[model samples]
Target: MSAPRFGRITAGPAAPAGGEALSELLAGGGARVVRIASRGQVDPEGAWYDQAEDEFVLLLRGAARLGFADGTERSLAPGDWAVIPAHCRHRVAWTDPAGETLWFAVHLPPA
Candidate 1:
């Protein structure tokens, strides 16, 4: 038997000339792993992410800002991470516009 293949997470779609770029790395068992490439992409006006599952996001490159429903916000740099509980209302406030901002997201069912 052969071992599973190895893939680079940094490999993503071509530079988004318009909107944000997204790629799913894995999905199963009530969980999903997604890679998001951003260049100043933010949640639409008056929009928020009210996911049914918890999410953990890691900043692999560039910088970003997260806004919570409670008015609190978080700034993330490379190597930073944030865990958002299920049903927590939040939205992306900012992403580095000068270069690529890569994010690794893990969505899991509630505990």
Candidate 2:
């Protein structure tokens, strides 16, 4: 027997929140892709991402800023991509206020 094959599909955009958006772009498999948006909101200190799953992200619109645990920061713009390792702590520092940011995120876990 063989596993079923999946095809390309559209994804749902995130709401007004500043979290990752899960969609059907990559579904029915171990991996998943989501569309996210940011509205320039900052989470409280100590709030970070330490998920066991690896995350790959791309900025499609507007500007994004990332703050790392090592006290380093970086800015991202449209067409920019970032790969965050599993268990890495990071946070969103800023976002373009003129408009919302369109981001695509993919989650990959150890096989």
Candidate 3:
């Protein structure tokens, strides 16, 4: 077995201009944990994500908004979370531009 690992999720490279920075923290048994840093990022018009895995998203800092294909929207602040089912179309509607918005996401294989 491998030794355990530990680190700060908030400690990472900055998000690129007009883009987000993604760090894969762990992956095994068809599941993955990721840390995402964003600043003033949003999906392009008509763009959406349809993932094969279910996603659990937790907002750790700043604020954000998520838009669904069904014309619904959800706002998120620090400490807020949401679970997105596989193939559920969604997009990043907005993110705080003044500072970094950190997100912790766990992706698990669809049931």
**Among all candidates shown, the one with the greatest lDDT:** 3
Runs off by more than 4 Å, candidate 3: none
Q: In candidate 1, what are the lDDT values of residues 68-89, reduced to their tens digit?
A: 8898889999999999999999
- Estimate, for each residue in 1-111, the C-alpha lDDT of model 3 and write its tens digit: 999999999898788756799999999999999999999999986799999999999999989999999999999999999999999999999998888999999999777
lDDT by residue (8-96, candidate 2, tens digit) is 32334544655444454655457787767666655566688787888898988778888888888889999899999998899887776
lDDT of each: 0.86, 0.73, 0.94
Model 1: residue 69 alpha-carbon error in angstroms: 0.8
Clashes (N, CA, C under 3 Å) per candidate? 0, 0, 0
Q: Alpha-carbon error at 80 in model 3, in Å?
A: 0.4
What TM-score, over all chains together, does every model reach?
0.90, 0.76, 0.97
Off by over 4 Å in 2: 1-14, 17-24
Better of 2 and 3 by TM-score: 3
Superior candidate under TM-score, 1 versus 3: 3
